[model samples]
Target: MRLTILAPLVAALFIAFTQPAQAERVDSGVPGMLFDHDVPVAMNDGAKLSINIYRPDKPGRYPVLMLMGPYGKDTTMADAPAYRTSWAKLIAKYPDLCKKSSCRYIRFEAPDPERWVPSGYVVIHADVRGAGASPGVLDPFSPRETQDYATLITWAAHQPWSTGKVGLLGTSFQAINQYQVAALRPEGLAAILPWEGAFDQYREIAYYGGILNVAWQFWWEHQVVPNQNGNAGTPLIDSIGGGKDTGLPLSQERLKDNRIDPVGAFARHPFDDAWYHERTPDGRRITVPLLDVANWTDWSTQGYLAAASRQKWLRIQTGDHLTPFYSDQALALQKRFFDHFLKGIDNGWEQEPRVAVQVRHRDGTTWRNEKAWPLPDTNWEPYYLDAASGSMGPTFEAAAPAAKSWPGLGEGLTFTTAPFVNETEFTGPVALRLWVSSSTADMDIFAAVRLIDPEGRDVTFMGNSDPNVPLDLGYLRVSHRAVDPANSTAWQPFHPHVAAEPMTPGQLYPVDVEFMEPTSIVIPKGYRLALTIQGTDFGYGPGAPIVHAKDYDLPDDSHSGLFFAAHPNRDPALYGGTDTIVTGGKHASYLLLPHVPPRS
Candidate 1:
């Protein structure tokens, strides 16, 4: 068979990717950063958003670094066994990670006052609206909420301790909201530093591809429960208010008028329409200077890879979503960026490389710098699928096209490559071109790229939401496969998700599925790379620790990290049927990888 011949060539050509020579490390340390907790700012629409100001104690005017999100501004930093373990792991690898104050006072995702305040910057944190001590309804990541961010940014620039220059900083909710506000181009907004934030509401946040995601249901319910200003006897609000009322004394009946139902809205709109578009940013309109940060291991990996702006720089790290925001190297980069734009410091930031990346190997990760992303010299290699052998190789014969089917809503088919004879590495965006047919009118494709060790064990990484997760995952609703040629590249395809084109049962349709995260994986000789085509997340087990949204915890913290909701489409009647993948000849299917050739 043709498969037998190509396997040897694939092994022979497999070579490890190269790491870049080290670049100079930049650090700008100051005495300390200070703060003023629970400051309130009044919005033009007569809403009050809670704010926390962190600035120099010396009282001189300075540029403001503001973070606004649905997470309560009053949340405190505390110790946990897991967090302590993460800290120990980080410090053990990089001893200088804590060279300055550990910035221990910094809450989970907000800017650390200990670092920024001492560096001639004022760090501000605020509860957007309908959350924390802020009064109103909880309509998160909405246009109205985004406008409120702009209003708050303008408010900080005029403060007595502010220099009238402002920049945005934070992670997840704090970071993603900047895309919306930046498009509005608020006055005094100098730049943004969005770390692992989503810009597309439909594809990035609520729905993956077109199927509804229940992975964040528990997080969604608990994050806003305790922090509502009018809620009676909530510990966080009560503590901040000294046992008194936290905000305007609106009755329970009146307070109910202020919130929007996110889950209900999701159910009402199953497709990407005006509702999702309004929340998503207009990328073309975002012209602010950007220091967009992303991690190789997060769900928000797509946002960072697709980040676009006139003056933008990217910094990619290797860790879970929250790690980059807390790392010492990351903080140094953030301060250096703010210093140049906000304080007029001649820090030579303009001369810095446009892209800095962390290339991950199983043994360890190496840092590399480049002038742009997707390395200009990249050799885009395609590995053809051989359905008969359940494997991937460099070539396949067209005479015998093959098809395989599996339960549409269960563990689906997987194709693995043979053990490598030499070390091989994969970096950058990955694309799956498939010739698929579903027994039903529509199908959802969930594709995952996995690492297989020499022992045949799966090598996992820390995902944005869950620990011990696969290297990368992507999804596509077959009907939503129409591409936006104007914005899409060969390596990364852009699907508009605007209209659905249903398929006739058993009719093969060519579909492009884009894996959201850009990854760097090094496979040693005797190791393999596997691709799983499934309808759900690759699971570890039922007892895995649940990861929730920021500040996501129950009142009693009992079911704080639980995932309770099920996907609406994951049912026997709705989405359970056979799905087929065809390969060879006109139905040529392949995996597109960004293959970086090793240095000569």
Candidate 2:
């Protein structure tokens, strides 16, 4: 922690004097926009990062908006197969896109230079170490990489055309890096708009809920990061500009030496160990203003609930992971935030609601502004479960205890509530409290929350990894359910996931599994909410589309595989046993929810 605090001060001074006052400038002759390609920026550690600058063609200072990630800096939105699928359609949706020019220089997640340059802002994009033309090892999300990002922010602040103020923006890869960099408290980093990214690399990405899912490891290491390796003829670099002409490239040996084995590293350290803690953000140290945006569709929203900052605003949007970043409503709100902070504009941002949520329903969505997350008006209620009847309701009999047992690999039990008499909304995080037992020493709990329409059809929404996923999902290795009391809240239980405390065979243990992803749904008169508790990952029935839309080529497969299959905690030799759900009397099992009343 002290390292993050101390490095920023030293780096700040170095940035002030390193860059030339009026060194090199390129005039695009396109009126308001100028392009500076393959600009080499030096880092404190003697590494030169390949950066591209986009700003007003005229000679004047402007606030800088920057992004740094492994995705090659030369990777254009038009060249990537995943992005080309919807780039044209997405651009058409936002008429404000490239309002001044053709927006030809837009990257996958970076802001459109065409729109920002004319607005008196500079947009800088960089390829971090071991990626693209940048030399060094690709240690994604490590402290070294974070320091490199901090240095880049300071370097931008001292540029000839800079206002000495910087802000970070981008989605997914770009957004996820902001948390770690901000934790360092970079000198010129005035604000951050982390539009839907995970703050905790281990729990959120490497091993979700203490279960190992190598799909991401395989996808990222094999395709995404390698695509941007510091090789001479990388496809992205070649497409943007001749690879050899862009920047200096490293030899094959250097690229391999710099890269870390993410898959092997994850499998080696199954628990929340020092490696993970080092890479994760120290949220308590963050002091900059934050406009964190997440979506119900992307269940990957732990950061929204975990981020700690004095000037922070949370917005929950609807749609897939990429949709929120491209939405017109989201873009305007982001511009307003950056305007107020980086540009020092009197945009009335301080008066805006601290939390803005877009609640979803079967037919459409509704926007609501509140003073805080888990609105002060939230009515915390519990729906008790009856194992004997496989039903859930407001109350359950306590005298007669009932227990239901299911195979560790089976579908398990589902409890649904009675039809609602009036429109009621279930908003915010949810958790399940139950007394569970495993025939073996361990059991994996996979729970999902879904809505059942009057016609008895299941309601699905877009998920960060899968298109048609349940409203919310939770996972817990019964033995690893130890909560970090300091970080845990009633609505969102924080499982340290530091180690596994194997269960006593056939012995019931009380535990709470909290679904970090928030759900906002209105239950109409005839609708019901269902809680499905299963042992394996949930899957859509036969004939159902694997995903609802053409999604970005993220490596994580959230659709049909058991997250525990590759994990030691779920070893068949020790895990394939019957799990029992005990309910009633002393062992009261129930689902806790946030019930929000309609606005007056």
Candidate 3:
């Protein structure tokens, strides 16, 4: 939290990177970016709403870069883990950012107008009603709140000196609302760059492959929900934003609100009903020119920029978490997109290739560009899970198999292979369909799809989250697993976790899990695919450690680093996710991957 000016002189730093004529600190005297302010706008339903504005300079007309999220925009992110991660990264990486821009004057990052101002961009950061400075009961991305966003845009476009042009940009929640508001067809909206925004609400949040992403829920309840307006964390009549705290507060009575019940809600419905569909916007409605960005190792891969590549003009890249945004190469790409779209300059960006990917390999660094996603002519290979023995079954030679289980009740079934002979490349969506049963009403079907080399070193690489955890893995929950047939294609089945149907203790039911759209990893010929099915959480290293979140502890952390909060059985055999097993056949289960062919 030490604010250091990278440049010795404020006067010197002012014009160092500018046109020299009129560069200044451009101060609004707002101590922190957390200001409770609002500009009333009209919604489609004739409802008038107010939005908080974070500006580059007060009372000036500048290009607007707007972002919205569940977090209270009226409060600064300086104290939050999510904001801290981005701030520490941004401030450290871009020393010039602290002084060169308004990073030192940051609050909630994506919506911080302070940072954008030095770059001459006006940032309209708002608290969704029921969140921060805005008024209304918080519903958190519900259909009603979305209307407020649409109205916010329409109003922002009409302000004098506005030029009626607006640009949307942000990551995660920030990136997501851009799509939702854009879908509203706000007239003043010009361009939007949504980075790694979660498109599928169910698959990304309520459940990851059916298993509830406990970390996400934990952050929501503890970190985010606690800090909203009217919460103990916010101020009432503070002169911040030069106004009163008008926004509604998050309900202390969460059960009465009924909107944030992650477990209870997800446990009720089992389909991609109107709720999920309403939350997700069709990429087609987003006709305005856009630049969608995705991280190679994003922690919350909820709002992944997967289907985005199919859009005409999207930009994809793989970087270590926040590196892409901080690094020179990626920033250059962002500048190009902004210059072309916002500045109305001919940056020659259109001539560039559509997909700018960091094609990862089993080795260290990897980068590649392409004109399309899942590039045409991709090799589709299927690796079957043969249950009779502990090897991936041959497609045709395998005879129908019966049920089998791991020794302990919750240990899970493991399948491995002898090392490969050549460098094999596998990428894209990896799907798993299993006819599974559990002794309890509900169970979590965990999968560890790994790449092992010939010597069996167990290939591991840095993931988007904790660098300690390996990247090659995905998970799912059986009760929350319900696929959207419309979105489920040949290679992957996108699950809608809106509802839950707990498992039959001993009856078979189909379980579909969608691994994120990953890279084409070239595993040497001697390498193999190791899929381990468990009844618990994943481990980072041997002896297993709980994959703790930057925020909350998992439900149950008792079993080998696995945090299980739901319920615990006293007897090891009764509650432990032991005696887990796997079975494969025409009607049972198997691994369905993009099985890419070896490229020249």
TM-scores vs. true structure, each candidate: 0.85, 0.90, 0.76
lDDT of 3 by residue, 320-406 (tens): 354455445655666667667777889798787776555556555566666665566565565666666777634522546667765
Model 3 local distance difference test score: 0.55
Best-first order by TM-score: 2, 1, 3
Residue 221 of model 3 has an lDDT of: 72
TM-score of 2: 0.90
lDDT of 1 by residue, 1-600 (tens): 111111112222212112211222212133444545565566666666777776676857889888886656555433322234445544555566455665444555777677667667788778768777677777877767877787777777766777889999888788888877887677679988888777677776667676665655554556554556666644543323345224655666765676666766776777778888777776766678888887675544444444456678887776666655666767788888988989889999989888888877765678888777777777788878888889886665442688888888777888888888888777788888999998888877877787788777766655554545566777888888888889888877888777778889989999999676677877678978888886555555544343322222212121111122255655665467688999888888888887787755
* Candidate 1 lDDT score relative to the true structure: 0.69
Give candidate 1's error at residue 576 in angstroms. 0.4
> TM-score: which is higher, 1 or 3?
1
- Give candidate 2's error at residue 413 in angstroms: 1.8
Best by TM-score: 2
Encode model 2's per-residue lDDT on 72-96: one tens digit a residue: 6666666665566446655655666
- Per-residue lDDT of 90 in model 2: 59
Candidates in order have lDDT scores of: 0.69, 0.74, 0.55
